[model samples]
Target: MKSMKSVVPHLSFCVFLLCGNCLAAPPSPEALDACMRGWADQNLFSGTVLAAQDGQVLLHNAYGMADYNAPIANTCDTRFRIGSLTKGFTALAVLQLEEQGRLRTSDRLATVMPDYPHADTITLDMLLNHRSGIVDHTTLPDFQTVRRTSPCALARTIETFQSLPLDFTPGTQFKYSNSNYILLGHIIESVTRKPYADVIQRQILEPLGMHGTGFEYYRRPIPNMALDHTLENGSIRRAQDRVMQNAHASGALYSTAHDLYLWDRAFRTGRLVKEKMRQKILSCDAEYRYGWATTEMFDRKILAHSGETEGFCSTIIRFVDDDACLIVLSNLEGCSMGRIIQSLSALLFDRPYQLPKKAPTGPQASADYGAYVGRYQIKPGFFIDVTTQDGQLYRQATGQSRLQLHPESKDTFFVTEADARITFEYGGEGQVARLVLHQGNRDFPGDRL
Candidate 1:
């Protein structure tokens, strides 16, 4: 291993062959402050960043105000919607029930909910993996149509899908549908014979002493909570007010940076899920896993997830071996704040933290596009079909409808709706041999199939 500084102006490859070859360039405290301040000043990041390594805090800071109109500044204690990060908590509750013999991961959905139409084929593992083939009941046309003026209660939402068959066979593919977690929540309610809130309270919140975390709707007043915001035509507006309708399990939990840190600590050290179950939660799927998506950095395993809604964006990164984590929560949507936090964390750890390279636009290659237009294996038994329409790439896996992808480069494209991306790694054979799915700060290699 050798450390070679770039002597050439911009053309570069200062190769380092080993972990020790990478030197730590810890950002000075003052430099970090200036960096964050610059971000806020330019409206690049208006959120909180907390990073810890080797059980020591390198940086923990909040920028801007909790509410733009009010003078109250954002602080480490200000709560923000954790969004899909809520799924991790729900997964833990299910594991707890499993430990109690209330259920098993192999239990069929039909056993739990006799009325669920496709329950006969859907298993607990299917639900956790989002492969139940159950329709994203939340996205049915009638959902947004009839749901416009009337808000259905959680139980009613679950009941609406009782007669609907699955979209495909269970455990055959990966599709990110909120319907799975919502059903998981219903299972929790059914088994405990208690409200979802109470179950979460006893199993996770109370046990973790996360006194400041809970599910709250848009209109409710959350103490020390930051109001979600969105950049609208160059102005920042409070943005967390849209009705969640029946999406609680999908994205409605809120918590402060500190509570999330506690949750992360519990997760990494197995204070929550047992060791084996923790591995399941962090494993990657054909697309994603039970809760977190496993990734690799310098060959080290990493588990990560991100949450987003109308006005909030949140991300959690856990270094499996290091017992370290990074949690970033923002009130604004469509900002580079999350990437900035990731870069900062990578900088602190002396890890590669480059931002998603901006996508080349307007034109695309003929052979380049065609080579990537086939299915590739991301995880065992799963694949992503790369297709192009009018030169834009769209990714569709088994049991999922195609969704357009935003290109970061010819070889790399990211799904803007969530923190997921695909990168093509060329082989010595002069062919696109492998594709890497980058999510939650971890990269999963997908060989061409």
Candidate 2:
């Protein structure tokens, strides 16, 4: 999975706010529309959004173009490849199967896939909560080439990473790995003697009337589907295609905001799974449950998840106790779903919020840019490259497209295309020695490499 650079920081806070008794009324439709319009006008957002409270729709709208090449406008019904948001559905499928007595969360992986490496040590519950030690297949070195090639058979896909060393001992650590869900998908198929897509279609989509949703596959014509796009060097362009089958249960589903709202409603009404299973899905015992992450925002409990794939980004935030939810589905990759979701949450709760504004354009030239032109290590395998191209400053994270940085101040630079800011720090020797990334209300410090 591509690191949701801006969203991961917020997941770390997980603040449990107690505001049930003091919950604010939902924002007016006009206010919410205006807020989204501001983001669309600033090119910070492009897609569909839906917000609701206490089972009442507060706002549902679409913004910007669905297909820039075709000049097609986005509509509330336009479907987007929802990326990792599909994991929630996959989790739901697993829980539903358990409810049917076909499986149990406590079952060992060996019970389903006996030959899988370390299968005896991992449990379904561990995979459900992302405590499985399986390395994320998407992070493997050959994943890029694999995704571009013809879809591999499920067994082949499993074989590619099945023997790789575990990232950690099973159930001993929490690491988000798409391989867990892929394995779950395989197990589901094994138990039911059916394909994963067929099981999901029969079990969830049909029951909830989510007619606009289905598995995304190569060469399939999905009506009203929005073509994914990405921000490249400050310009929006079409993203390369991936064989969605490779994403499998991890991220192969496509749906509309309305369809996703139906999904949220299903959880609220306990339509698919019983109350006990629902609680298991939302339990905060593990920071992540099933496929959703449990976090606290605005003094209310939140069941949320963010999704990112080639050129699509999506997020769903559920204020569960309040029966309130927010869904954003975008075709443009690198759009700051975290910032947009935070602002919308603030507006929904009647808290102070600011609509996006044009990013400040500082002096066109800065001689100091030379000092910041080096790679900085954020983590063992992640680094940010600050470089100059034709006098413009740019920043690129490992394995990500470069984005131009506009000077916000002498030591601070901001990315106009994303809700990200960077500040260069000087060492005792007066040399630029480190950089800090500011996004999603958190700061990530990186040392010069």
TM-score of each: 0.71, 0.89
**Tens-digit lDDT track of model 2 for 108-194:** 999998888898999999988889888877777777666545687777778878999998999999888888888888999999999
Give RMSD to native, each candidate. Answer: 10.9, 4.0
lDDT of 2 at 357: 40
In order, the Cα lDDT scores of the candidates are: 0.69, 0.83
Model 1, span 187-208: residue lDDT tens: 8888999988788888899989
